[model samples]
Target: MTDDGFMGPPWQMDWTPKAQAVRDTLPEHVRKTVDAVRAELVTAKDPYFRGVDTDADLPDGMKVRPIQSSVPKGPRIFFFGHGHGWLRHTFVRRVEDPQIVVEEVFWQ
Candidate 1:
């Protein structure tokens, strides 16, 4: 295993149709930020990299903190993005697949 105890390869990433649509509608700057975040997430060796439990408050500023659902098992559902500007994207990481699927994108 690697230093982080992660075995196998890094997680792949994909975006749902809805999430892609939302991303397409984002302003240039926000879209760039989202792209950067996606790049970082895909390179993560651990599935829970930088993730926080959903119950916890989000971090301040442009930092990205994945918010994991409280469910004890099954596919992981989480979101990460700019906590302050409300640019959030929800994702699902299935147990069977080494992929991070972006489910929804929202900004306000």
Candidate 2:
């Protein structure tokens, strides 16, 4: 149980985890390419991050940022957690063909 008092896992767990879906959705060749992308990421000093990931072979409107917190700084990719309300149904984390930009970095 969490402080919000719900008796369940922190995440809904209704959908497959994002990275697996990306691998499953691609053709074998594409999957291999994705694997290579991942291979270059895994265990590397460079960071991997994403905001709102999806099961596809393209950018997820993600802000691929350089993590200069340490050496070999590069894009950091990690999946986004679900948005609280309607966003989950309306959004699947695919980078829109027309990119979305967030001008301000807001942290509470």
Candidate 3:
């Protein structure tokens, strides 16, 4: 198992068709930030992505939080999360097994 308690080499990240569609709608810079976050999930040893918050509505250890911004103005300038601006939201759900599934990415 990995350091984050996930099975295999590290965390595995994947996107669904719906998620892909949402991601595609984002601006280039915002998409790049989201991509970086996803890459961090696959490479980072921490399973919970440490800094991100848990999704309040979803039970069973699901986490949802906005991705950090690289720009000085912050994530608000490019994406939208929970109806905000240029925000990138990541969704991680832990299954019964030792796997961590990235269920969705919200880019609105």
Candidate 4:
């Protein structure tokens, strides 16, 4: 348990091939931003930390929603600001492994 009394262990973060491809295209500075986000995400009790709950809460040009097409309750797609653009990604929590799997990534 953490100092905050959170029960579970920190989640490991993994990126899908498609997500890696998108990440590979990012400029070094933007990649650093993504890495910073990953650092926070890996230790978060909730994978959706810092993410808004509804589309209505999204900032202009940002997107956040549940991906229905995904299996086993589906992953969540969310966006966060990176420089002038938004970095969008989808993540699913795997309880068995205590990991957050990033399924896709796009910059817009």
Candidate 2, residue 84: the lDDT equals: 13
Question: Which candidate model has the greater TM-score, 1 or 2?
Answer: 1
lDDT of 4 by residue, 1-108 (tens): 546554454676778888888888998877876676566556545555334543443344344445554442456665556234444444444445656777666665
Cα-based lDDT at residue 48, candidate 4: 53
Q: Per model, how many backbone clashes are there?
A: 0, 9, 6, 0
TM-score, cand. 3: 0.45
Q: Which stretches of candidate 3 lie over 4 Å from their true place?
A: 1-9, 49-100
Error of 3 at 94 (Å): 10
Give TM-scores for every candidate, taking all chains together and pairing residue i with residue i: 0.59, 0.30, 0.45, 0.58
Q: What is the lDDT of residue 1 in candidate 4?
A: 50
By TM-score, the better pick of 2 and 3 is 3
What's the lDDT for candidate 2?
A: 0.30
In lDDT terms, which candidate is top?
4
User: Alpha-carbon error at 70 in model 4, in Å?
Assistant: 13
- Evaluate all candidate structures by whole-model CA lDDT and list the values in order: 0.55, 0.30, 0.45, 0.58
Where model 4 places Cα greater than 4 Å from the true spot, the runs are: 1-7, 48-73, 82-96
The deviation in Å at residue 96 for candidate 1 is 8.9
Candidate 1 colliding pairs: none
Judged by lDDT against the true structure, how good is candidate 4?
A: 0.58
Q: Model 1: which ten-residue window has the lowest total lDDT?
A: 53-62
